[model samples]
Target: MTAITGALAMAVAMGLGRFFYTPVLPAMMTGLGLGPAEAGWIASANYVGYLLGAVLAAYGWAEGIERKVAISGLVATALLLLAMGVSSNVLVLAIIRFLAGLASAFVMVFTSAIVLSHGLAASKPWVQSSHFGGVGAGITISAAMFGLIILADSGWRTAWIMAAVLAFAGLAVVMRYLPRDIVRTGPARKEPPLAWTPSLAALTIAYGIFGFGYIVTATFLVAIVRVGGGSSLFEAGVWLATGIAAAPSVAYWMPAVRRVGHANVFALGCLVEAIGVAASVLVPLPAGPVIGGILLGGTFIMVTAFGLQLGRQLANESPRRALALMTAAFGTGQILGPVVAGYLADWSGSYTWASLAAAAGLLASGAIVLIYCRPRAA
Candidate 1:
């Protein structure tokens, strides 16, 4: 039940709250006459808030009240989605996205701590996979909703309204199933500080690079389809493919982790995702975006799961702090990806060069892991 609830929470917070923007971006662009540069600015605003939220979560301030913090995030997410629906001004939208990003980060940190800790205590590692699967599930749901809105000839505003309703429904499930008093009611104990090591530093760098590599396509895949003259339905289908591939990715890669170790698997996933990112702009329309979307969906989530798991292992004495540090690195990369990609798209009139650069970053990320973080033989 805890695992299921956690998945629902993630679906609401991450799938809808954060990533739903990707699917909705094209419609917003069409309706609002937004250029890539403006879109990038809005996306970067969210990432900025995410970076701040990660830093805050790293502190001990919210330790014992993680559940409450998570719930607050959910509430804020739902409201912000509604707020998005009502706003047309670029600055207002950016502010709302920024607040929403902050809320999503809070949900991510607290909910993962709750769910992963429970999974570890229960000796059921599958719980971790199921919990993360919520993100893919949520993405799938949003894609479906977007398709329905497209069928109705509704705009992005309607999509946001529907998203708010969905988030509220997920929030209700989490409130009912997730225990009210999961954490002890008292002052939180202080955790030992995370020790900086060469391996850990390399992993952090790799994780940040992975963030920059994946986000370019993640942010603009639907828009890219539009540029290729694909119908709205086809665009939604491509996103749906991504969600479908993502749903079971963590579970699918768990066996690989046992065989190759986390860092190696992480490296391999980066290589695979780099192929997908390159495909997005290199290959011709339809097939190219579809294949790229699949690869993106299939690897990004698994890599994310492994990266955080490796961070926890490396910072055994301070998992939460390590997660915060890694998340901050990732957020920093995320902030740069869209701005760079957006302006490049506006200038070059295509995503080819920007995407190729991102793929290079992924390749470098993989190399870093293989060189510096690979586990030694016993």
Candidate 2:
């Protein structure tokens, strides 16, 4: 039942609320006649709201906001995705997306705490990884839906309605099933306890840089390919396939990291991720995007999975504050990736500059991970 709750919670509260935007955005821009800057601004608004939510939750002001909060957040996000289809005003849509993103941040904090307390254990890396896969699953669903309806010349509203329906169903499951005790891992660690150990701080900074790097490609990879002259189906297919394949890829990636050491494993992930991003800059071909998606899909999720694990391994802080600090670093970087990419694209008149910048950040993160993380004993 707890696993079911985690799965459903992720599908609604964390997954669709956070990830569906990018997959559907291409169809949106085409059907709705939206501009790049406006689209970027909407994405930025989501991140800003996410940032605020993370900071608030990390500071202990977010106590009353747990299981029920997740249900409300998912409900709002589902409705907003539908609302986006009907509303023509960009400002209105941005505000809706911002709130949804904020909702997503809080949901992640709560659900992740649940997992750490019960679901996350050494014997269950693959099982725990599936929960993270929910985000990709949401993206796949949204992208596939958009591809089918878009070819039919159906409006973006159809996609939003679908997202809403999915969310409402997930919410019903959460209400019926999620455990009520909410205290993850015995009594919670004392409030205001120290959160940033040397290892934890390195972990946090590395997580932030990873966030900065990954979002640039995830947010804009399809758009860049579209601009570079790839067909719509090509972009959509790669996106969906990445989301679908990512669940299993963690099995391959995390163990390799565990054996090779976290620092080197993380470096390899960054290296591969950078290669994919760099390809997006040059190839503009179907092969380039597909390969990029495979690599990106495989490792990014592992980085996240391990970041949380690594922090917990090293820290003596509350699950709430420790996870929040690590994730807040991640979320902060994610929030910036798109807006910065947008500005670079706007000024340079090409997506290459933005992508290259993202690639550089990934390498930089690799350096941080290698330097700061102590090598495990062989």
Candidate 3:
């Protein structure tokens, strides 16, 4: 029951609250006369909210009232989506998105803590990773909604309205099933000396780079494909492809990570993601977006899971603090990506430079992780 609810909560928090924007972007642009720069600004606003939310989570404020806050966040997110449909003001949209980001962060942090801690105590660590499948499920469902809107020739406002409805449905399920009491598996081992080893520092930086590295593509891929000669069907198809690839990624990769070790798998995932990012620019027509979507979807969530798990191992003494720092770094990187990419696209009249730059960041991130986190010679 906990696992089921955990995945559903994630779908609502991340897939709907965060990523539904990807499929909705082109529609909003066409309907609202929003340019790449304005769209980027709106995206950045959400990310900034995410950063703020991460900070709050890190500080452990609202610990006792987590359930109330998490439920409120989900409700707020649904209302915000409905609000987006009612307004065309860019500033208003930005504010709504920012608030939605806060809601999403609360749900993610609180629900994961409740779900994973309970699962761990029950000797079901695998259920913890399966919880992320909710993200992919949410994305796929959102894409399907967007596809239907396109087929009906409905405008962006209608899309937002429908999405809000879906969010409410999800919220209802979550409210009914999410565990009220989370059982942590006691304390996490004796406190290890809090030391900043080179590897730890490198992993932290690499994690940030990964955040910046992926956000550009993740935010703009549908838009880019639309401009690059894709039909509405093709545009929706790519996003659905992304969700499909993402859904099973953690399960598929966890065993491999266990065998090869977290550092190697983390490095490899980054490198693969870099290739995917570059492919979006280098390949022509639909091939680039299609193949790129698969690769990006396949790795991003896995890399996140891997990085956070690795952080827990490193900060054995204070896993929450370590995870918080990593989340902060990631949120900071994400806040910058869309703003820069959006303006760069506006100035250059293309996304080529932005995609290339993001790919390079990913490559550099991979190198740092490989070199610094590599196992020392025996």
Best by lDDT: 1
Please give each candidate's TM-score.
0.97, 0.91, 0.95
Q: Cα deviation in Å at residue 3, candidate 3?
A: 1.3
lDDT of 2 at 132: 69
Please give me the total number of clashing residue pairs in predicted model 2. 0
The number of the candidate with the highest TM-score is 1
lDDT of 1: 0.90
**Candidate 2 regions off by >4 Å?**
61-65, 120-125, 183-189, 376-378
Q: List the residue pairs that clash in candidate 3.
A: none
Weakest 10 consecutive residues, lDDT, candidate 1? 179-188
For each candidate, what is the lDDT? Answer: 0.90, 0.73, 0.84
Q: Candidate 3 at 132: error in angstroms?
A: 1.2
Prediction 2 TM-score vs. true: 0.91
